[model samples]
Target: MHDFSWGQLVNPEFYIKLGGIYLVLFIIFAETGLFAGFFLPGDSLLFLSGIYSKELIQEIVFIKSDFLNVLLLSSLVSIVGIIGNEVGYWFGKKSGPYLYNRKDTIIFKKRYLFQAKDFYDKHGGGAIILARFLPILRTFAPIIAGIVQMNKGKYFLYNIIGSIAWSFLLIFSGHYLYKIFLNNLDFDLKKHIEIIVLIMVLVTTGPVLFKLFFKKKEGEDDNSI
Candidate 1:
């Protein structure tokens, strides 16, 4: 089996060449659990990972590959994601007022925390589920929920449901379609991977852009009034 180099893990150009499936789990954990991982790519990673499973077993992991394995991977990813968010929530709860009172820096911003709080207040418990599909919001929602002292039982339920939905929707969808179009597609998939990833990023971020625009328009109307 082909092994990836350590350098590949951090290199943006070769980020996908990290320690196979382990890297996928790490990325999911970091993105959901750690504040520093706010910039990590999530949506495209899930989709591409699912597609790569078709060959990863034969070429990299060196195991028998099948859709069942992909399903297992998705389940593992979702479970890890749930754990990550749970950790985030715990961290937020433990940090408590320290985070609230901290000054903004290049990496840490009070505004982000405030925004997350505002979002949580507006959406209530549902934000935990909805935020899974969002980028920045997803990372901060659980933390905000904890900071606000939302019910643990409710949070857990939402986290589990959201993780399952997000993982299956993106990862499984990619694997399923890859199988269907394995021979039917005429284009060079390898050549278009970059484009495909770019599209996924845009699609995932679309809602955030829409929300910003709507908020701006609302503010304009408020000023006019």
Candidate 2:
């Protein structure tokens, strides 16, 4: 059995080295649901899977799966990702009161919870959907929703849409773009897989960082005013 540690979760390569479809699925689930998993390489892992999906299928089953198969399987794992989020929500619902009552510590602050609740209030249902594409927030937003008792119906509706969008977009982008490069450029993707994953990480998170900077700037302007 492979020993799992927090250090290993930062690299998708660790799970890839472990070599099983289920291990990848577990990483996705854990990352989406557990606070400790917030550091896991979600974007890079999805990108890597897209790059390796066909090869992975062949290794496990001795036959290659086409693009459609990769797409379908990616969607299925996305559903599991939704379930993981719900688990996190349930945990927050059950533990939220006690957590709120606990004395504030450096790592665990009540003010942070209040800020999350305020953010959720300002954004409404769409925050859940948007948070899917943003790391850290993706794990905590759902929990904060539960802590604040967000409407179950609205939460589920947005959660489904977000999970499907997040999963399919990243996975298919990786898979198809690799195929395109192979066909058009005579590129050996494996030789530059690490660079490709790094680029994907930036592309995925760039928008979030951009928005955060503007939001911070706006806050400063408002304060100055």
Candidate 3:
């Protein structure tokens, strides 16, 4: 519930509160790029952060930099996320069976592996796009791809695509949405567009999750076959 009045988030002190947008970028990187990052707040936090940033842009005009700064910050974050995903993939590939079932871990073994495998089995590219929006899944999806020994070329492609789609979508959308409101001097200028984007993301993700879920269930049934 960032105050929509007087723009609290844009305060130079406030923007610096978490090192401005860079903090957001880093969090996105870790969440999207790292498997262990599944525990991090992804969607809700990003959404709220965006809403706050809207106020910042309007109330605090002197950001000490221009939109380029925001772009650079976001791009850096995207790189971090992508690299994190690769490393996480390597770890999952190396440690999936053991660490997954280890008493030290809280991950539900069957659930994690099942979703990963399911996504890998059916829609290879689709998982990357769909998972970009879904929390935790973004980090683990690529790692799962790596564990399963997905084609390196193909994996790289999907990874890049997902990273760009997810990273840009969130950062730019949040910033732009704020711009619209600030420009119009209205509090709810593009609430409809925001809602639409959210719906689109969910609508796009539904089939991927469903396919994975059902595929996993079928695989379980097949085990008894």
Candidate 4:
């Protein structure tokens, strides 16, 4: 954990730090904002990285580490997150139908796609925001949005709104929380990063597992049907 997190989360050198921000941005885009990015970290990492942004302002970017800067970084994260998701929507539109269902395993686990499709249908465009908070659903949200051929202008509007709310709330929350606790002495970088990483794993993965289980159960019922 010590060597694991670079200046992004804790402390480190120079050049590596520059790459981290872009990487985090890219992941946020690919994961929540993109199709295949469902495997990427969403809320948890957003929160953890949000905290790191505060630290970044204080040290790296030289952007006075104050509440004002907090707002700026938070807004930046949200904007980037939403932008990433929009790009993902395009990607999904380009590729989703061909991958909608498996030929051999039609009934294996169609619940996610079906649910995502329905949600996108009813909500119009706001599903983008809802999906940001839900990792597995985030992956499907944009794809489904595309599949439905949602109005491009409306989709962008909703995506920006959702991304701003979701990204700022979660990441800034993480940033503030980390600030409150870690500011004290006896700092534990490894423990801190480890906890954050663990949280990311759970936030990203736990829902996936639960969805898989429920879908499996649904599959069994369909088999019985």
- Candidate maximizing TM-score: 2
Cα lDDT for residue 189, candidate 1: 46
Cα lDDT of candidate 4 equals 0.67
User: Relative to the unseen true structure, what is the C-alpha lDDT of residue 71 in candidate 2, on a scale of 0 to 100?
Assistant: 73
For all candidates in order, the CA lDDT equals 0.76, 0.77, 0.61, 0.67
lDDT of 2 by residue, 1-225 (tens): 557786665666667768657777877788768877787777777777877786656555654448666876587669978987888788778888987898999899888778877777777578888888777778787787888767777777778888888888888877888788889998966677667657766776888889889999999999999
TM-score of each: 0.80, 0.81, 0.60, 0.68
The number of clashing residue pairs in model 2 is 0
Alpha-carbon deviation at 96 in model 3, angstroms: 4.5
Q: What are the per-residue Cα lDDT tens digits for candidate 3 across 106-210?
A: 655556565667767688788766777776678777777776666667777877777776666766666676677777876663445445445545755677789
Alpha carbon deviation, residue 186, candidate 2 (Å): 1.6
Off by over 4 Å in 4: 1-18, 32-35, 58-61, 95-118, 124-126, 183-190, 203-225
**Residue 157 CA error for candidate 3 (Å)?**
1.2
- All candidates: CA RMSD (Å): 4.6, 3.5, 7.4, 5.4
1 versus 3: better lDDT goes to? 1
